[model samples]
Target: MKKLSYLFIALFSLSLMTTSCREQKSTGEKVEEAVEDTGDAIEDAADDVSDEVEDAVDDNK
Candidate 1:
């Protein structure tokens, strides 16, 4: 019974270690992420500008 308990504990520790050692993002992945974020920011800014333009047009009328 004690041997089995030790084996279980060792296995649990090993699994925890492996789970924490996740694969890091490569350079290409990082660049892709940055580009995606920039795209989202640009889209948001464009939406804000469109809204402002509509508001100004309504005011002029």
Candidate 2:
């Protein structure tokens, strides 16, 4: 009976650990996606600023 209880507890603990790992993986993926989106937005803004600066320089010339 004691051995059976131990076996059950081990299985339960293993399942809980696996579930926690999966949750962490999903959260990590979301953070990675958000970072990528932020990078793209920054790049686009930089391009727009560059274009504006070029136009100003041309006008001055």
Best by TM-score: 1
CA RMSD of all predictions: 3.6, 8.3
Clashes of 1: 0
Alpha carbon deviation, residue 11, candidate 1 (Å) = 17
What lDDT tens digits, residue by residue, belong to model 2 across residues 1-61? Answer: 9999999999999998887443345888899999999999999999999999999999999
lDDT of 1 by residue, 7-56 (tens): 99999999988886579999999999999999999999999999999999
Q: Candidate 2, overall lDDT?
A: 0.92
In angstroms, give how far residue 12 of model 1 lies from its true place: 12
Model 1 regions lying over 4 Å from their true place: 1-19
